[model samples]
Target: METKILPRILIGAPGSGSGKTTVVCGILQALINKGLNIVSFKCGPDYIDPMFHKEALGLESRNLDLFFNDKETINYLLAKNSKEADLAVIEGVMGYYDGLAGKSYEASSYDLARSTKTPSVLIIDCKGKSVSILAEIKGFMELESDSNIKAVILNRISPMIFEEIKKLIEETLPIEVLGFMPMIKECSLESRHLGLVTAQEVGNLETILDTLAKQVSESIDLDKLIRIAKTASKIEFIKPTIACGERVRIGVAKDKAFCFYYQDNLDLLSEFGAEICYFSPLEDKKLPENLQGLYFGGGYPELYLKELEKNDSMKQNIKDALSAGTPCMAECGGFMYLHEVVKDKLGHAYKMVGTIEGESFYADKLVRFGYIDMEAEKTNLLCEEGMHLKGHEFHYWDSTNSGDCFHAQKPLRKMNWKCVIGNENLYAGYPHVHFYSNIKSAERFVDICRKRKTKI
Candidate 1:
């Protein structure tokens, strides 16, 4: 792979709830207003923040997970997506230093910053301490000497105390104080049990984004920030290894219950000429007509168990399609929906699609969490036997029984409450696999669906 140079900026924070999302949204809009073709990304396993990025820039924002996606694929995705864009902005996960099991290899913002060789701008929450802010920035910079910390943006700073903090940071840290935003109460994003409220649920989002962009542009130094981003080192680009013959049309379940899809996955599908059509499992009677494949991403299926149970016909239609050998892929929440029954945290049970002969129950403890290198033990839609794919597993649900129905590889154990399943045509697991890491998986899935169409 040859090196490909592109301007990029990473927006991260000292920790979660530090107003990083607000800062990123403002920066994205500001860049877009400058007529720069901007592409955005989220560091960890999140589907909602990217949505806001998309709305702000009017271009789809993708995700890069050190846990669920491999290094090669991450490089390829950044290279491919950044081809026509003037700049790429990535939002970090949790704290900049937080990682999985205390290891920096997976789920860490620093891991992603290093992997892409992008320069980072720390967004520090300046509430009380003024002069001591320099120490915090120095600690983060020294913690990861390899990472490029170009600038710092102080968020939630009161105008009365802003000059003191800015002067201290400028006098001490080697980096520049790019800008700061006053503590605007209305500018904060709405939140729910999982994370930020889904982008769809927020009504006045456009007005909010526009206001945020205007405010940041008026306060921040855009020219210096752009120069800092341009100074970052470049990464090599790699072409996708997997290819397909014709466009494959896939039906995806996209309701309130199943919405946890990686934007990059959908973008890659489109690149391969796959037409994605969405259907509501909560209302639709059947899958989209003439669909070549079906994908069920993760979401809060447990919360809407009663509504899904009431949609008996849709559940039966999915079960019948699976029984007829349709190529279908289901992730964690999707996996739960395919089971015979799903019991919530309240112990309320509801009937689900019985495509898999098992029952899922919400557990008091998380069943599994962290990165996994999964190798196929048998050929399926995802990959051929022995091919490995990198992904992460995080769920609070556990299965009641294994049964002798589906087959998985060594690392996946039934007793450990990692994987459970139904038929060969149907795959449901806790680990969420980003398609870019294993393009062959999507190719194989589409191939199988096309073959099934030929038989019909």
Candidate 2:
């Protein structure tokens, strides 16, 4: 067992839209301004919020999901990423106690805090009530044996009553009232069908971040926050083992059209000896030379149909590679890009790679949205027959011929369905897989890439 003393604090909310992301970002930038080396983390499988941390603020942000990884891995990931940083800021998902299916606390933020032994700060939305706020905090603290909540931050409250509520809460509850954040209208982030629009889409992103940092520095107590973060104990974990095998070059599609990738997934591949070469299908004219494998993750392909269709050479490049038996793995939006045609919300069709015989169109609503456990019905690139894995599906698009290579069942629900189009060299489907859920699948993919490279 390995142990590391990590100074960390988790920002959790009673539920979503309590301004968790905005608060975390504000605190992160303010800390960075104070010459503190800060590393950020998101609790669950969100790919976008981490982008805000990485792209917008230029800080290294990683995901720590209890659903995809065990406690040991979570601790290892936290310790591994926070090695050179002064503080680690974790932003919780959905709600503090809300976890899988809204029934169990299996993968909740509280679960994560206990597993990693990190201190927590609860941020309550103080819009509608006053004295009732203390009841909410007390209930959360007593709901579980150990809530791990150390402090509180009130959001969307007026400055006039800040001290009034702060004093009342400190007098009533066992937790310390950190500070309050007044609603800054222009600094708020805009949302589309998915959560916040990608950090790149916001026109005034830099200005908004600057405004948030300035506001947070003035409103929030940085000294108290730092003191709480430093109180976190040491984390104990088992180091992961990796195979130092043959090296393989894999071309990964990364751009505005296809940017949904877990940093851990790519890191695991590299740890297993695959040199990832990133290329943009949106701008690149051709695939990288001598690629052993191709990976296209999920992103906003539907929004940029015209631009993707205009890149005729890149589409043909991908189609030709897939046809030649190059190993490939694609999820949600990436699966849509392989279709013969993709229709936007207005029903306008645009040509795509034509690897799949059907077209992808917006479903108007989320289809099969949640966590899923998958069992492969036949042998495929990443697994053998009857093998099981964990993944997630959160997309608003559907394909005309969504394949039936795997049987998927939603956790805690009686629903089961058929999906995926798996073969010896391809695993294209709507379910986004975290490689750590079953590291063997990741290792298998790396081995396949190595074999392909050897043949060439």
Top candidate (lDDT): 2
Q: Which tens-of-lDDT digit does each residue in 1-456 have in candidate 1?
A: 767788898889988988888878888888888899888888987777776666445776888886666677788778777878788888898889888765444568888888888889999998876777888899998986786778999988887787787887777778888888887777786243125245666677778778988988988898888998898777876776555567777889998788888877777676666789999998888788887678899888877888899988888888888777878888888888888888988888888998766789978886656656666665556777666666666788877753322233323333332243434465577778877667776666677777777776
lDDT string, candidate 2, 1-456, tens digits:
988987999999999888887778888888998999999999998898887789888999999999888898899999998878999999999889999888989889999999988899988889987999999999999998778999999989999998999999888878898888898876765243136367766788788778888888898898999999989988898887888698899999999889999998999999998899999998889999999999999998987899999999999999999999999999999999999999999999999999988999889999999889899997787888888888999999998888898899988889889999999899999999988888888899989888888777
Q: Pick by TM-score: which candidate is best?
A: 2
Instruction: Give lDDT for model 2.
Output: 0.89
For all candidates in order, the CA lDDT equals 0.77, 0.89
Q: TM-score for each prediction?
A: 0.89, 0.97
RMSD, model 1, all Cα superposed?
3.2
Q: Which pairs clash in the backbone of model 2?
A: none
Name the lDDT value of residue 301 in candidate 1: 87
**What does the lDDT read for residue 452 in candidate 2?**
86
